[model samples]
Target: MKMLLTVEIPHEPFNSLVRGGKAGEIIGRILEAIKPEAVYFTEQDGMRCGVFLINVENPSDVPAFAEPFFLNFQANCKFRIVMSQEDLQKAGLEELGKKWA
Candidate 1:
């Protein structure tokens, strides 16, 4: 399934990496491992953040997606299931509404 991975990187470790000029290198390595469909850099609650869209095909694969950040940056990671338009269309919402209502 498609998942959204949100990473909030703390100031100390990331600042050290940036000061040492290794930030991009590590980030590139992590990105290569995850192979996200899309990634964006932004700030969340005053911390540097990364938002990624990726596909996790199995339940056990969740850590594989989030662990790079955890091991590398001690980053806080969150995973949320997401859907494309085609996925929404296949959700059977109308049928469920009839059944539930």
Candidate 2:
């Protein structure tokens, strides 16, 4: 199974998580551990944001990984995990990720 992980947030979220800070380092490690097929983010106003997908072997395992993020940020975010097809033609995976990205 292949997974596409999407982390959507306001523009500043990128800075808080990836701009050479301690939090950034922690996030980098988390991303590496997850080994998401891809990573993408988007801008939302007033700090509200959305994360699209985080593919994993067991779809149910998302919360285990997600809880840390929520705790770290003290923010509200939504997550969704969907089983994907091995064949791209049938899965339409590329098109799906771009819809939100």
**Which is the leading candidate under TM-score?**
1
In model 2, where do residues sit more than 4 Å from their true spots?
A: 1-20, 48-53, 81-101
| Maximum-lDDT candidate | 1
Which digits, one per residue and each the tens of the lDDT, describe model 1 over residues 39-98? 999999999999999999999999998889998899999999999999999999999999
Q: After aligning candidate 1 to the native by TM-score, how far in Å is the CA of 3 from where it should be?
A: 0.1
lDDT per residue as tens, model 2, 45-78: 6553434355556768777656656655554555
For all predicted structures, in order, the TM-scores are: 0.97, 0.50
Clashes in predicted model 2? 2
Q: Any runs in candidate 1 off by more than 4 Å, and if so which? A: none
What is the clash count of model 1? Answer: 0
Clashing pairs in 2: 5-53, 6-53
